[model samples]
Each structure stands twice: as C-alpha cells, then as structure tokens.
Target: MTQHLHTQADLDRALGELTLRDPRLAPLLALTGMPALRRREPGFAGLASTICGQQLSTHAAAAIWARLSAAVTPLDAERIRRARTDRLGRLGLSAAKIRTLKAIAGEVMKGHLDLDELAGAPADEAHARLIALHGIGPWTADIYLLFCLGHGDAWPAGDLAVQEAIRIAFVLPTRPGTKETIALGDAWRPWRGAAAHLFWAYYKLAKAPGFAAAPALAPVEAGTEPATKPARNPNADRRSRPEAKPAASERLKRAKP
Candidate 1:
C-alpha cells in the first residue's frame, strides 16, 4: 500500500487477466477501458472528496463537490476545517456527510494524520490511519486508496454498485455484504481496484439491454470477436473456487452513490 502507483498497462494487464477468467465480469473488465493510476494528492482535499463521495451517485458527488469548491476560495484543509456546517451544506451536503467531512477535517487539523505520510503509506497502513477518524470506514478508505492513493489493489465490497453489479451481472441470488464481498473479491487481487473500476464501467453497460447496454469497447485483442456471456451467478459462492478471497484491501465505500 506504500502507494506504488500503477501504470495504465499495469491496470490493463491485471484487468484483462481477471476478465478472461471470470466470464461474468468480462464485459465490465472490457468496458471501463484502462486509466493510468490517478494520484489525488493526499490530505484535506483528498479526504474531503472521499467523504463527500460516500454513497452518493457519481453525478451527485460531482455536483456537490463543484459547489463546495466554488464556495471556498482555496478549498484546502485549513479552509474546510474552519468553514461552518451551514456554509458547506449550502454548497450541497447532507447533515451526516457534513459531519463526516468535518470529522476528517478535524483529524487533518489535529495532525492526527500527516498528508505526507498517507501519500507514502502502503494500502493497509493508510487505511488503518484513515478509519481511525470518526466516520472513515472500509468503504471510504477503499475509495481513497483506489482513487486518491491509487493503490492498485484496493477494493471495496461495501459499495452498493459493486454489490449490485455483482448481483445482477453474476446473477447472484443474494447481494454480498462486506464480509462476503471481501471473501468473493479475493481472486481479483493486485487489481481489485481495477476490478471495482471495471464494475462501474460494466454497470454503465448493463443499465440498458442490447445496444444501450453495451459499453464502449477498447478494441479487443487481436483475433477477438464480440460475444455475450451469461450473467455471473452471485448465488453461487465462487468462494470455494481455486481463487482465494481478496484481502478486502483496506479502503473506502460509498453507500448508494
């Protein structure tokens, strides 16, 4: 977790390998394409973004963040720490999220977390530190690692979309909770974060059936042709398979967003 940034190829290779093995997850692995590990500098902005994004729709999180950013001159750690709840709320945040944001800001202010240290910390250590805060949890921590820290292996099963995506795509009769999801995601190791990214991309595809459901492909490998596969059977605990569960790689989660 010491933040060994993953290159686009690193992510692509990991995703491609996972896609080929898991028929249910293949399309998603294909759709998201690949992104070079994006490093959002750690500390106030990073923490704030993680909290604000929790459980909110991607569009909703973006809207709120835009407002928050506009409301503050230099929306950095100090500013967020001093800003009043009303100010942040007006910018677009629920009461809970505002509190969560403040808690994170307070930690930053108190020096409980050194932004520099987090940037350098590996995935688990960084996650352990983040969750020490009032509201940070596996889901939130996972998101931060995946997006902010750019920890290649970070994965969050708590994410509803991930759970939902897994449920529908894999045809899982039941949705996996944190423990179960963690257990299930084990095989995606070293690229679990990429898998999460893939799922989001896959969700975009599965939203609509047929053409609308199809995700924009990134050109299949040479000699490959497009074909559909059956959804994953979430009910079938793939846990027993040769693949082990992913280490749940400490990270963050979003409730519904």
Candidate 2:
C-alpha cells in the first residue's frame, strides 16, 4: 500500500520514521523544526497550478495564476480544453504553456490520465504516468505527487533547492545532479516526500540573510554559491533558481511544445 502525507499528523509521523531511518537528518529537523504540510487541490486545478508556477518567482507565478483562475470559470479540464489559446495567453500563460495545458485537458477528458487515482499508486508508477503526458516533466510530476496528491514517497530529485540543501547538509563537495540526487534519495525510501519538505525548509532558512550556520554542520560561507548551475530545460520552463531571475516572457520563448 502507498503512504500518503495528507495531513500534518501524517507528515509528522513520516518525519519521525525518516529521522529514525537516517539519523543524520535529526539535526536538520532540530534546526528547521517541524516542516508544515503544504498541499494543493487535487486533480486538474492542482496540476494546472503547478504548471503555471514553473520557472517563475512566487510573486510572478501567483499573479499569473490569479489571473488565470479569475478568468476561467470553474477551471476544469473541460473548460480549459474549450478555452481558446489566445484567451489563455491574455491571462498570462505562454504559448507553450497553453499548448501543454490543452494537451493535459485533452488527456484528462479522454480518461487516459487519472489524477486522483495517482495518489494511491506507487510513487515511481505515478511519476511515470504523469510524465508520459505532454509537457509534464520529472519536476512537475513529482511536485504534483508530493504536493497535490501528498504521496509520501514522491521525491523531486530535479528540484534545485532540494539539491542544494542536500549538498549543504551532507557537506558534499558539489551539488548533485538529478540522477545523483535520485540515487541519494534511495536511503530515504518511503519518507522522501517528508525529506523534501525538510530540505526545502532548510534551504529557506539557510538562504536567509545573516543566518548563522548550524553548529552540527560546517559553516556555510557568506554569499556562498552552488558549485554548478542547473541544466537548462528546453521543453519547459526551468525551475526557479536562486541566482538567476530571467523575465518570464524570455523563459517562455525558450519553452517548446
């Protein structure tokens, strides 16, 4: 049976098991406190929201999502499939995103992708099914599983923030790439989603101005940078990076359907 972190208690329980499984993470939990369970609506709206937030800052993504949500009545797959590309463009979606959303809507309508059922599927299987759809990548699929469906084992190995946090916490010489990150997550097993939450919390705290390094770990240098830049995504918007802030329009230009 698949585990789901659908509530705060569920996440806390997973964190407990995770800390016991990997004692190194205990210090991280101590420093970060209990990470909150952040969830989105399930199904089409949830997945669509994740798509809108891709490669954009929190404010930018939220702004566009607000526009899209307000403009589209109901915001269901049927409505999205029927909506014109131009109309969606005026709502701040890039041409590529518009195509992607429509394609997803079509898939949902055809009953080829069952978003709700994915919550019950094994993490790897769910991830595979989601990525099989047009415009859905590893990051997007894992984000949906972890945040939307609350799958306990869904690990977002491609997330730059998680990669950086792991590098810092493990005191690695360099940030791990996606494949390396995925391999590193093997030990975490079913609690990888909880680990992702912990790492994201750690990343935020570590990135705060004048934040002192934890005594349990090596001192993080002031203004320290990741050892490598994130690899660019040609098919979709790159995930948000701490060092780079390209205009959303520029990112859209690079995104292909």
Candidate 3:
C-alpha cells in the first residue's frame, strides 16, 4: 500500500518509521525537529500553480499566480485551453510557461493525462507520468508528488537543498550529484519523502550562523551529473514557501465521485 503524508500526524508517523529505518537520521531530526506539512490544492489548478512558480522566487511566483488567478475565471484546464496566449502573457506568464500551461491543459481535456488519478499511484509511476509532459521536469514532477499529492515515497533527488543537506549531514567532501543522491536515498526507501522534508528543515538549521556541525567522516567523492538538470528551473534553492491563495471564484471545488 502507498503511504500519503496528508497531515502533520502522517508526516510524524513517516518520520518516526524513517528514523527506525536509518538511525543516522536520528541526530538530524533531533537538530531540526519535526517539519510542517506543506500542501497545495490538488488537481489541475495545483499543477498549474507549480508551473507558475518554476524559475522564480517565492514572492515573484506568488505575485504572478495571484494576478493570473484573479484574471482567469474558475482557473481550470478548460479556462486555460480557451485563454489567449497574449492574455496569459499579460497576466505575467512568460512565453515558455504559457506554452507549458496550454500543453498541460490540452492533455487534461483530451484525457491523455489525469492529474487526480496520479494521486493514488506509486510515487515513481506518478513522477514518470508527470515528467513525460512537455515542460515538466524531474523537480516539478517530484514536487507535485510530494506536495500536491502527498506521496510519502516521492524522492526529489534533483533538489539542490536536499543534496546540500545530505552533504552537510553525512560530511561529504562535496554535494552529491543527482544519481548519487538517488543511490543514497535507497536506504530511506518508502520514507524518502519524509526524509526530504526532514533534510529541507535540517538544511535551514545547518546553514544557520551558530549551528553545530556534524562530526567529520571519511570524505566520499560524488562525481556524477549535477544535482539538478539544466532544463529545470533554477529558483528552487530557497526554502519552499506557501503560494498565494486563489480567489474564492478560482478555488477548486471537490469533484463529484
């Protein structure tokens, strides 16, 4: 069965289980404490919002999302499909983002992609499906799985913060590359998503001015591809922040079963 970190309790349970699976994480957890559950609206709107945040700062992303949402009525696939490119551009979306959004909307309407169905799918499967889309990259796919769908097994191996955190915690000579990061995450297994949350929190603390450093260990060289792909948006270095809330009219309503 797949695990979902939909609430604080779910995250706590996963973290506990993860600590048991790998005792090294115990100290990291002790340093950082429990992380908060960060969730977004699920379905097409959620995916679109993720796209909007790509390659942009949290404040910039939130501002653009707010303007876009206020301008687009209902803020769904149908609206996106019917919206003009120039209008979307005027709402602060770049041409590339506009194209990506339109492509995703078209897929959703054509039944080629089912955003909601991916929620119950395994993290890897869901990730593969998402990355297969025109402009969605590994980071976007993993983020959607972990944050939007709350898939507990989603491993964001390409995240720079996670890689840096791992280097600091494990006392590596350098930040591990994407492939090395994936290999290291194998130990965490089904709780890798929780580990991701833990590491993100730890990253913040570890970078703090007076935080105690991890004990020195044998240096391991992680020579492989860079932590993130060149195609991915580069603005993910900052800690994840909440996106702007959509207007009441743009909020997603529960779909009928």
Candidate 4:
C-alpha cells in the first residue's frame, strides 16, 4: 500500500503537494498555515468514540465522551459491550446512539470487524466494510479513514464545515452538495484529507477574533444552478446582527439511525 500520512513529515509533504497542485489554495494556506493532522489510533475504542460523537458538536461530543470514558474507566470493546444500558444512557447518549455503539462494540468483539487490518486496507474497501455496519454512514466512514486510518486521500464530501469553508474560500454563491464537493475536491488529489483539515482550520480562523462569522451561504438546490449574487437578507443589517443561526453541530447534525 502507498504510504499513509502517519507523521508530521508525511502531512507536510501532502500540503506541499496540495500547494503545487492548486496555487489558488496558497492564500488560504498562508492564512491557516499548515493544517494540524488530527490522528487517532485504529481501535475499537476510538471508533466507539466516533459513534458517540455522531450528531453532536465538537464540544458536546467531547463532553459526552469524557463522561462515557470516565464511566467505563478503561473503555474497550468488551467493556462497552458489558456496560449496562441504563449507565450508558445516563451519560447523555441518545437511545439510538447507545444501540449503535453497542452493536459496533459487539461486532468488533466477535471478530467480525478487525479494525487494525481494516486500517491498512484501501479506502474504498474500508469504507464498504464500515458503512455496512448499523448507524455508520458515509460521513462516519470517511472520518474513520481520514483520521483513524490516516488515509491520505480521504475526503468527507458530506461534511458541512467542509462545504461551508469551500463556500467561503471559493466565494461560491452557495454551498456544494456531495457531488459538487467531490468534483471540487478533484482539484486536490491524494491530499484531500489534508485539504479537509485545512478547511476545518480555516473555518475556525475565519470566525476568529475580529472576523465576522462567515455568511451563512445556502446550499444550491438540486437541478438548478447557484445564483451569481450573494444571498441577501434585507430584514437585518449585516453589520449589527450576525444572523442568529444554529450552532454548526446543531445545524449539521449527523443522520443517526
């Protein structure tokens, strides 16, 4: 298999390649610097954490994960499988998430899913296996490949942060859907995962101190093209009121089973 980005040097190489591939990203890269590679070891516990984090904001996910981690103490597949439903439920996990979490843990414990070997598998092969599991969707599978497996080219087209960041950076009149996002991501091959990290960093930096919240660009409707003009809200003044909107996690909740 080709080398995955398992080190800082690997990530640097990917970013450098990205800059050469598309100099348009140079300005955004300069603003954001090298994006941080948020790597996670391949294991049942880390995957379980991803399950728990579904549909929740980063802050909220971290909080719930903290509680679950503390409760389980040594959160392993067996531990999670054996944990009482009431206890897990008390940790603020929704009923659906709890069931999904247990199912994933059970599958791993039963040797039905070997995460280590899976990590080494090709991205398409790995994604096929992951999405076959209950409650795990494309978004979850892509995240697993991108962060857990460190797959160099993994890109989560379904991610709203990525869509929003692209809207802001490209100055698109609207956010691109999965098809559009994938097409746009074609500009950055092999380093698409790094591109994802850069977009997340850009999302934060764009909303950094003194910078206005990036305009809430609407997604272009199906079968129709996006308007050339930026979306306008005549009722509220753009300067005074930062159009009150749902938090990213809230507005962009995962499609949980």
TM-score of predicted structure 2: 0.83
Q: Which candidate should be chosen as best, given lDDT against the real structure?
A: 2
Task: Judge candidate 2 against the unseen true structure and give its global Cα lDDT, from 0 to 1.
Answer: 0.79
Show the lowest summed lDDT stretch of 10 residues, model 4.
221-230
TM-score each candidate: 0.69, 0.83, 0.83, 0.78
Better of 1 and 4 by lDDT: 4
lDDT of 3 at 165: 90
Q: Against the unseen true structure, what C-alpha lDDT does each candidate score?
A: 0.63, 0.79, 0.77, 0.71
Against the true structure, what is every candidate's RMSD?
A: 9.3, 10.5, 13.4, 11.9
Identify the superior model by lDDT, candidate 3 or candidate 4: 3
**Order of the predicted models by TM-score, top scorer first:** 2, 3, 4, 1
lDDT of 2 by residue, 32-106 (tens): 999999899889999999999889999999999999999997899999999988999998999989999999999
The residue pairs in collision within model 3 are none
Q: What does candidate 1 score on TM?
A: 0.69
Instruction: Please give the range of 10 consecutive residues that has the lowest summed lDDT in model 1.
Output: 248-257
Poorly placed runs, candidate 2 (over 4 Å): 218-257
Question: lDDT (0-100) at residue 105 of candidate 2?
Answer: 97
For candidate 2, the per-residue lDDT at 237 reads: 24
